[model samples]
Target: MNIAKNMEAIFVAAIVIASATSFATAAVSTPVIAVKAEASAMQTVTVTAKRLTAAEKAAL
Candidate 1:
């Protein structure tokens, strides 16, 4: 009976550990695309300028 109880405890612990590892791996894999998207947006904005801004500056 004692051996059976020990085996059950170990099984539960293994499941909990496996769940934690899966979640950790998933967390590490995300967020790379968001960083790439932001970099592309910055590049696009840097290449274009609003010509009207010059006229506005002259009026000022």
Candidate 2:
């Protein structure tokens, strides 16, 4: 009977610990935003230029 009671107490303790951990994790989590304007503002732009053909160059 004592062993059974001890097992029950351990099971309840494990459940309480698991629930507290899950609640803490959910409360302190950040949401993921697909379109973040703040992040986009810090991006850099790249530009490239190509040479024109001989005829095109003569027309310019």
lDDT per model vs. reference: 0.79, 0.87
Q: How many residue pairs clash in each candidate?
A: 0, 0
Off by over 4 Å in 2: 1-4, 31-60
Assess candidate 1 and give its TM-score to the true structure.
0.41
Runs off by more than 4 Å, candidate 1: 30-60
Clashes by residue pair, model 1:
none
Error of 1 at 43 (Å): 42
The CA lDDT at 47 in model 2 is 78
Pick out the ten consecutive residues of candidate 1 with the lowest summed lDDT.
Answer: 35-44
| Candidate closest to the true structure, highest TM-score | 2
Error of 1 at 33 (Å): 15
> Which tens-of-lDDT digit does each residue in 1-60 have in candidate 1?
687769989999999999999999898955665434566466533556657687798998
Error of 1 at 30 (Å): 6.0
Cα lDDT over the full model 2 = 0.87
Q: Report the Cα lDDT for residue 41, model 2.
A: 75
